[model samples]
Target: MKPLVILLAAAAAFGADPPAREKLPTSRADLENGEKLYQANCGLCHGTKGDGGRGAVLAGRKLSRAADDAALVKVIEEGVRGTEMPGAWQLSARESRQVAAFVRSLSRVSSKPVPGDPSRGAELYARNHCSACHTIRGLGGSAGPDLSDTGLRRNPAFLRTSLTDPEAELPRSYQLVSIRSNSGSTITGARLSEDSFSIQVGDSSGKVHSFWKHEISELKKERGKSAMPSYKQLSSADLDDLVAYLSSLKEAS
Candidate 1:
């Protein structure tokens, strides 16, 4: 099918009139309920108006254009593992749909980058020591996945989350590690740097530790979350600037 037809079909499925470009909710009550749900559950991280804070900004995001209601509902219910956002399966299906509606409402306006400043982002990357764990351009640590082509693979929303709450979104290969010592001590963290003889782990505290394979008597590997932390201290402008920087690092066409 043509891309235009697919878009129209998606719009129609969401009760949106293509020519009007207006989303028709089942009822006003649903919209209101969605707003309230967003406030109570998503406000702190995403901000009251979804401008982002401890969480990635949702306002003016283009996610709705890429994802439909069903996808949105899944994200809300399952939550993005390896980040600060937790699963919200407790919400009823109706409520989940309502929240999805609210999130979609935030995307009414598009938020494209104004030609990102890769140089500025490069400085930010170094200052933040992102290279300590993640690799970029074949230079950096091996703890996280190579980000050389992240611009193509991930959207801006996902990139923002990568900065703020990495653990919320878990990648496929990076498994979570739970280590129980012979003394009955336990530790849980994501693998940062690992090899055949030794493994390095980063805990929730942002502290990284290395251990030889023989040292861990009871090592359990589970689905690991992203080891990134929330940037609660960063101003909104700074967050946007950093996002701009990271989003610009796309592979050459």
Candidate 2:
């Protein structure tokens, strides 16, 4: 049978929703074929190992898009709207499934359920001013990552560690920066973008500041650091509640 026919047949089998279990290519030849397809199609953005560069990291991490085999297949076939991700309609449905399985084989996040009351954690999240930096469902500041999908993107253990020691796996993108203008004014904020000539920053107050390098007397890039403070000072129960709350935030499908 032709590849396009195979693709259409598979799509018809699943209909609107994905099947319960994703059928991955099992044989060595099949796996190799998937890898070749992945390299040709996905490697430019997702990286060969899916460690991420221009795209979100996929290696050893949980994916925000449907993580299951079937869901992954659907996401690959249909794509997410209003995002850089695009549907791979050029590929056959069987190829889409194959690539999804290969992507799944790259990483797996912990399935451990978060502990504590999510409602109580919600209170704690607000009390601790988590929204001062992070955004949830577009209701908070943008200094930190949007918590709308942290649960799907990060595992429980990673969330706990983030609160306890923020520097552990801080991405370079989130590094803090301080720039002193020639007029004795200082702007401390998270770097939004930077180039040799100019830099953009989002301050704690959710204000953006853009400055040319020549206008600034001093510019400091604080590496291996985050504007977010560690939560080790919080009481044990409060800490757990915060982690529980953060870990419970999964983007609605």
Top candidate by TM-score: 2
Q: Write the per-residue lDDT of candidate 1 for residues 172-241, one digit (tens) a residue.
A: 4566788876667777777766788888776655467788877878888875444555675766666676
For model 2, what is the C-alpha lDDT against the true structure? Answer: 0.77
lDDT of 1 at 94: 83
Alpha-carbon local distance difference test for all models: 0.70, 0.77
- In model 2, the Cα lDDT at residue 12 comes to 84
Local lDDT at 49 for model 1? 70
> What is the per-residue lDDT of model 2 for residues 60-131, given as tens digits with 9 covering 90 to 100?
667767666777888788877765567899999888877877787777532345577778989988888888
How do the predictions measure up, each by TM-score?
0.50, 0.62
lDDT of 1 at 177: 85
TM-score of 1: 0.50
